[model samples]
Target chain A: MSARPRDPMLPRSYRIESVESELPGGEVFSWTLRPRGGELEVGQPGQFNMLYQLGIGEVPISISALGEDGTLIHTIRDVGGVTRNMAALSAGEEIGVRGPFGTAWPVAAAEGHDVLLVAGGIGLAPLRPVIHHVLANRERYRRIFLLYGTRQPADILFRKELERWRGRFDIDVAVTVDRADASWRGDVGVVTRLIERGGFDPRNSIAMVCGPEVMMRFAVMSLERRGVPARQIYLSMERNMQCAVGYCGHCQYGGHFICKDGPVFPYDRLEPLFDVREL
Target chain B: MDDLAQVFAEEPFFSGFSDAQLRRLAGLARPEVYQNGRYLIRQNGSADRFMLITTGHVVLKAFVPQRGMVPLETLGPGDPLGWSWLAPPYKWHYDGRALERTEVIAFEAEGLRQAMEQDHELGYRLQKRMIEVIAHRLQAARLQSLDLYGNPAGDLP
Candidate 1:
């Protein structure tokens, strides 16, 4: 029997065009990818792309931004083998790309409601597109509150855009770090502390959060205690995903696949899974 | 009961219980011994009681044909072994096997439930204690996941 073609869900080819460090500590890195055809499947906010460097294997990386031209953008932290290789890729080097999978942020539902975006450390990557979309169509939403936290000021990703977002009238941005540096003058504590100071109206707001699972859990609890309905609290989950198509069981949590059913899920639907460790 | 109080005091779940309350709780606990490789509870079996290890180790294993009896976690002295007894659908979620000759104090769930129902203040205190135990375990699990799957981010040696 003729062997079936390799699944289309797997990327055929990828070329890294350039790399840059947005943060001083060299922990968080960004890359510009040049696909062979100079084209990529357009993805919505909160979806992620599976990136593979030849011989190194694959990882799920959120597409950080949509360029005015067509180049896809990714912001990655140097945390693992595949990522370490990805950060080292020079211009014209080959990599692989798959997906642009998982549910996107509820940008449509978020329209007309006050939007509260919470991110910690590299958690900001998944929320980047939503932030861009809201700012690009600024009048669609009432108010936008962005609460971000990192281990330290130096660990914050997209520092430049954070400044720009801070300047916008409708966007109220608060940044906190676990430890403050000499040049940093902002609140310091857990990210939940920033949420307390932001004073969001949970009744009319839809809150989107992405971070370490513990932080997300705490943020969800804080939001719920402050009156945000579980349905209105959305979370972006990070799990090991070998196949973006949901065939691999690596990303299964309860009945949902983190690669297919989420990356973003309504908090209420995910409550049971949250309680079970290693799900 | 007083003899068991020292064991209870050393357990993380009961550490928060006052010496007096823990002594009182020990009154209701019954010590049981198991040989190495014995099954303490089987997955999907009835969960009529909760167990707190006093000595030796137990392995919480879940059956998977691909990897028979995948060891999920190891519980040593002081860890509460079953959470199923707390709520209905009271069936053991995973198989528990004695990794070594083990001794544990088994607390009858129905008895504790009755005791709590009879005393609102005690119920609230015990419930609060259980919540703390659950939270601590959840935190440890999350940290373990980060260590296994997360980027070390310069924190690792």
Candidate 2:
């Protein structure tokens, strides 16, 4: 008989391998974790894990990338007590991790179609895995576009990666900033403006967007204007998730639990609840 | 200027204009080119004309005393460049600079305004379309001011 999956309620210890600050003030950073247990369960793109900070608290963080040596990576923005404490952790420090939970981006189903990824600020972390996946299986898709927008030039995430992607011939990458300094020479506007110049065939494209709620709302409108069906577009959602297993009522949205049923959902499925006031 | 009329007809901004209306607009338009770093319009300068970018980019900027030129937005090909010509005082509020070798169809504001007064139907259609463009830019500006991406709240899954 097949082995039953391990209990997700219990947390597994993971040692921090390295910590790199992604932004100027160290408010945003990435952590490479090594499982104290045998092997780490790799999370698919858009899936998240409950990162427990010992006795302090636990927060759900999206898996940014999967290391070749069975390690897991997560990029976090330090905002709350839990995240601020987690950011204080150094290499070799230990943190508890549970799950590779929730739904994933429809990478496999996107085969044979054009793929568009729109990310804003820290939202790019969750979509990075999908970018890696598509690039690994490049021949399976027709056209690939990555349009990223940040609050300012310094706020841009994965600068080197974005540069390398921009250099690539197969995939199209565009970066924009809400506010530009004298040094920034790229596009200056909301990310939706990039959609106007993206040059992708909306009818044959599958778009996955992760960003601020208002930005995503405007992006959906822009994508619809470009003729992409609502069903073909997806969004990564965020909420206050406590259990990460849907047991707690914290992350419930309308009829679904973001911890279990989503975190990633097609726009059509969430359209009804998307703009509903105070939902 | 039949060729120019065809170009105007092709632009989404002029989509509702009748063929005759496009021809009338084309009569007031003349192709102009600006090299990189050239100013298309200056702050508090006469807004004698407006432009429709045919190629390259234009950066909208406002100069601050300590910070120098701060870019507000970048307008690309097929984008409208100025609306200050439509109102009283008729002076540009900010600076418009060519980010690259840009080609634009510059329309004589005085001629267009006179035509609009004589042809109310044409004026109404053009004004309505301009209002839409203005509204879109206003919406974008509102979203930008929110600093949505900078807020760390709801950032985690």
Candidate 3:
């Protein structure tokens, strides 16, 4: 909860306290980082941080969860050389960390309404914290729904946590996959389709959606069809963020700098530019 | 029959039908229930009927040679199941099973086909709705086939 450092670009040295495999084949990992210098800068739900891999590179990864003892939990997919290298790092290895940056999900503002979280693939990582916050304040929200869809049963993230959440009577969690083999017994479809079956009161609900741009566009369309207003819906945008502080112009969308102005924005704010392909 | 007509009138699928059309269609429908794990339609079986799911879930699955049943999609309340009944050779391509005790307003495809042939307006309206359902499902299937979530570019920040 502390303020960011005076020089936003100055990356802090943090040692990886633990490295856990989040998915099979070690394609994805959850790394818990502890600041070697001081306390961890815990990010709000939907906020991302710039993780520097020494001389290699830095990529912006959303904070997946906050460890109980103040460590930062980041769920990362090994898609690039930097992420692949980071996955190879063992516990006690040091990496540069900056931010906890960008706008956050309006979890507090959504207190009195039905909270619907729609995620696809790795998009679930950013929304996991919002789920934790809502569950922690269970009584404040009327209903909470998490609709997630991934590529396959094998690609599902947070399997145990999803099962545990499903066990709770207060929250509704529906998981689906685009495809599955014979052994899988779950729903098979795009994440957007789950919106229709979510059974939330869209009129009084606030929806937070995160996924690929195409998936998010379809999700927004589905939410709108269910009567959720543009103002009540939020989306997390991903862009190439070289400088996490917005100086680089690498993550600009129209006039908004994703790093500072948003990684999260109300649907209404982006309506004009959302469907424009060349942006 | 009046009660069945009311049910059809209330369903989204039958939304624009006239009162007379609903009454005629209702004559072809009868209520059916399947308990959990019951097979609603077996693969290669005659697709003699289609249903308007009133409650519970139906999973459409295809059987693999060495593997077991692989689920293709799950349809629930307000969803219409089985379009194969409208086409020739009317055979189910996949098996539809109830994941829970399911209630549906089952329509006799043979009777409906006869009625449609007699009443062209009713046939056109019904066929249009079915086409919409088919188009929507086709679009969803295309999106699913893309494996959009599996695209590595989705992870790039």
Candidate 4:
């Protein structure tokens, strides 16, 4: 039998058009990338893209939002080596991309139901695409609720978008901070408290959450306690992803590979992995 | 009046407080228990409360798939669990799990904030104490990291 050829590391090439500091806070950085020549794959909300910094390394970053001009947007924090290198890249630089990987947000399934979006810190990057998709097809859903939490007032990502979402009648947005300075006048508690204050009918709502593992678990627990079914809740997970493809074991959580099986997974699928800690 | 009071009074952070202040602080805190493997604070979750370990040990863990639950540090009596509660965006930086059956005295963050608002002197004292605790932990972590990556000290006993 003939052996299958190994997949190439450079799956697709992307051109960086612009980089913008989306949040006034020092944490979030937004970048615009356009595929060179070839058409980019259409991605679902909650899906992620693996970005490689030419000479540095590749890291899995969630697609923040899609632009009307065909450019894919990514919101990243300058945390690790790969992201730090990415932040230093100027406009017109080229980077590598692997996929529009993982199962997307249940946008189609969520039609006709109220949708709740919960995000913490950099977790907002993954949930932003879902929000855009929901708002674009606004007529399909009954109501949309967004709850976001950050470490401090200055660290809130997507400040402009958050304000715009707050202005819209179709979506109710609530934000909280774990700690706040004198400038902050909003709720000064955990994001879970915002969910309690939002008063959504969990029975009729599908909740999507992204953030650090701890925040996602607590958010899901809070939602479940409010009557939201585990099956209806979706969570975006973060893991050290080497190959965007399933071949690498870096992103594995129990039996599932976060890169291939999901960066987005139903809450029930996450249950067994929750206590595993390392997943 | 309670086991928690006895433990709280002995903590280094409470050493400077007068007996009356210590009693008041104890009154503002509540004792809680956790079984082995229970999470006290989850990574990236809101850190709206602060906990002081009274008995047993808890592991400060960070999940990195390759190495599993990377034990960042093992904390025991007198250590504070959530420093983020002292600063804004009070989100937990990492997950804290009880390595054994543990008891803790948790101070409600909002109540502390309210108390701070009423008494600046008490607030300053507490904040200074908390900062010192954070500094000590950071130094300990740095030292541990050095031990992990530093040159070997030859011919150990």
lDDT of 3 by residue, A1-279 (tens): 997546788899999999989889988899999999777887899999999999899999999998889799999988987898888899999999989899999999999999999999999999999999999999999999999999999988999999999999999999989888766667877887788775789889999999888888888988997899999999999989888788999999999999999999999999999978888
Q: Give the interface RMSD values of the models in order.
A: 16.4, 2.6, 2.4, 16.9
TM-score of 4: 0.63
Docking class for model 2 is medium
Using Cα atoms with residue i matched to residue i, what is each candidate's TM-score against the true structure?
0.64, 0.95, 0.94, 0.63
Q: Whole-model Cα lDDT per candidate?
A: 0.78, 0.91, 0.90, 0.77
Q: What does candidate 3's lDDT look like per residue over B7-120, in tens digits? A: 899888999999999999988899999999999999999999989999998889999888788888888898899999999999999999998999999999999999999999
- Model 2 scores a C-alpha lDDT of 0.91
Please give the clash total of every predicted structure, in order. Answer: 0, 0, 0, 8
Better of 3 and 4 by DockQ: 3
Residue pairs clashing in model 2 are: none
lDDT of 4 by residue, A228-273 (tens): 9999999887676778678879778899898888888898988887
Q: Candidate 4, residues B121-154: lDDT per residue as tens digits? A: 7788888888876765554444333322121234
lDDT of 1 by residue, B1-157 (tens): 4778887776656756777677767777889999988999999998988898878777776777765665555566666788888888889989888878999999888888787888776678888977866775565445333422235445211
Tens-place lDDT per residue, model 2, B94-116, is 99989899999999999999999
Candidate 3 Cα errors over 4 Å, as ranges:
A1-5, B64-68, B153-157
Best by DockQ: 3
Which is the better candidate, 1 or 2, if ranked by DockQ? Answer: 2
Pairs of residues at least 3 apart in sequence or in different chains that clash in candidate 1: none
Candidate 2 residue B70 Cα shift, in angstroms, is 1.3
